[model samples]
Target: MSREPNQRLAALMAEAGASNKGLAKRVRETGLRHGRRVGTTHVTVQRWLNGGGIQPETASLVAEALSSKLQRRITPTDLGFPTAASSPVAVAPSYATSLPDTLDVLDRLAQQSLDDEQSSGVLLPESEVNSAVLSWLISHPDTLRVDVPAQRRVGMRDVAAIRTAGQMFMRLDFLYGGGHGHKALRHYFRQEVLPLLSASYSAKVGNALFGAATEISQLLGWTAYDTGNHALANRYLLSTLRLTKAIDDRMMGARILSNMSHQANYLGQISRATQLARAATEGGKGRATPRAMAMYAAHEARALSSAQDHTSAARAMNEAEKHLERADSAEDPDWLSYVDEAELVGEFCHCFRDLGRGPESLRYAERAVALTDPQYARTLGFCRMVLAQSQLLNGELEAAVTTAGLAVEGGDALQSARFQRYVSDFQRDVSSHAGVPAVQAFNTKVRDALADLDDE
Candidate 1:
């Protein structure tokens, strides 16, 4: 069977400044380090680049050679080669059978996510996502290994450091968008968190440490989603689910499922989104606080609205509203702090908009805008955009233009690809009214703002 060229591998080679002959020689040297006399050459490298299949061991050698040159971890997956992670065996029944296996997967995924050159435009198949969710839902947690042989003996202080760093990264992500600080966050995870995971720790420390890791992994997934690296986001989320399960954080695991549902809805996998959201809601029954429960219900409403399940969607939205009214922040996980009134209103706006309830959408959108904190730039921008869309749908073209203009102004500061899509969507929605003075002006504003964003 003819295969497409390995653009991912080619991109990595370019980034490593490795020519065909040079990379082949490096691969051979790496093989020699493993007690193998591999006969790799420029021809072999060219063939590999041209979509010729490589042995798994040879692929590892290639990855090792690139990692040595780049001074960072490079797995076979990063080079678009089939690894245990991608193969049927790796993802077949579950994510992994042990804590170390989960860590291995997380390490490889973090490396792949950090390599923007390699991961750009790559989206994993929906089948893979389905498999991941299924595995998480059915698989039991592996045996926890708190006692590990390593240089450092970790404690609560170390776990607190990891949690603090993750919280800081989360704040930055919320404020400036994922593209703004994703690289630095990934570097922190690899440099700071990775060592802690490998260090000696008691069960107490391990639970706290893994909890922090779960938070970081979830943020990594969210940031990846914001930056349009959906496949990487999916991988990170799966790792997070594994971590949550290992730590026996049932509520946190439910939250991860809710996030997966949101991503699935965004990807147009309506059925899967609904299933995942329902799973989250059911699983969170006894474990989640009201605020966390609200989040799960809201995501379910989102998927239901997209699927046009009007009655079911309304029921879920009502449930979300009720939960939010009783939400006690102190009782909820720190990660769920962002899912406050404004966030719930935003979800309501989204559901109404998707359900074609323009008037209701406008109400929720306006409330979302009013309730949103200015520091949350991306959320405010999103609310404004939703308001503009609702206005346009309600035939208030001038009002739509004004709202869209504000969206452009606020959203342009964000480095998020999703925010850019919001701009594009509003622009497309308003393109029909281009003859109107306000619409034309808004169009001009969009053009200038997008140009500036591109230049930056």
Candidate 2:
């Protein structure tokens, strides 16, 4: 697809009064200071202004160069480049220590994300994902107390409000898809939650606040991922990890890691996804309930399947089922209430499909669809697509077309980019059978449904 010019970058350069030659010279000079050879020229700067992205390393150096000249922290995102190329704009001292520092980072990121000019279509690099997973794994418990001075004192009610907001947003995301409510969630965080973080509180209250914030942040990340903003999602997940670690909330941290693994898997970084899934399991050890463990194991199985390691993937799936058998809803965290048999079966359908086990995939997909709540329109839609794909793989072309039509019907009720992509994928999968009358009718229904969605 042809990309529009990076007018944001051009505007920044114009505002800074930096000519292409000047910026190019600054980049080379900055690269020299970092002991790297940069071959940037005026033409290179021109291309960047024209929507051509630079290498991640180059983007980092360019941000630094601009920061020096502008006397501020100018991130690659601010320059309209994909954030995957940039190191986090603001990182805490360490994930293991300092709640104040971590909160500061969160505040900055939340603010940046709220900006009207924030770039889109940014992805998180595989290397960044691996780095974040490693950080989470080695992070230790903080012993220091948080005692920030503020005009008002935080109470349990304040903490409860944040938690309640998180839960509310989570429900909205679950039923309607993340794109429906993520912006409002972010607004609530910036307006309501961030103030709580800054308020005066005892160590106990601070810990509670951080824990609640972690949950909300992770949800924001998941929503971003669901809506196809992978780079922002990665940053939010990392922030969630740091906040959870600061409060010594390993279970939440593990959940956040699992969420990251899902994003990585979708992005085709199967190896990184596996690493993150393993990290989630390790982090949750001794704390997470069996339900949580089952979720983690299922995510790992999906990652392994993506890597084409069918033997290991099957073993992981078996392990996931074992954990699921031991799960009790009463013993699990509220966050894990969604990880029931249907969810597990949905994941298994994905895992088996990725492993080329068509019959197994079809069976699990059918079970998932049958068990899925009607309110979960997006999930049901995706499961139907999975079922249709399996049907096609099993040489049931007529059944596949019928299932795809049902999938489109389910998908038409949602506003998720991810769901739309799933529908598109199913469309491509059944393209070979387009000559079939059912297939043609299904395609027409999907096209009209998608057009309606676009209009909305």
Best prediction by lDDT: 1
Stretches off by above 4 angstroms in model 2 are 1-98, 112-117, 144-148, 411-413
Cα error, residue 18 of model 1, in Å, equals 36
In model 1, the worst 10-residue window by lDDT is 84-93
Candidate RMSDs in Å, in order, are: 10.2, 10.4
Model 2, TM vs. native: 0.77
Clashing pairs in 1: none
lDDT, residue 266, model 2: 92
Q: State the weakest 10-residue window (summed lDDT) of model 2.
A: 88-97
For TM-score, the strongest prediction is 1
lDDT of 1 by residue, 257-305 (tens): 8988998898888988999899899878887898999999999999999
Clashes of each: 0, 0
Off by more than 4 A, model 1? 1-94, 113-117, 120-123, 411-413
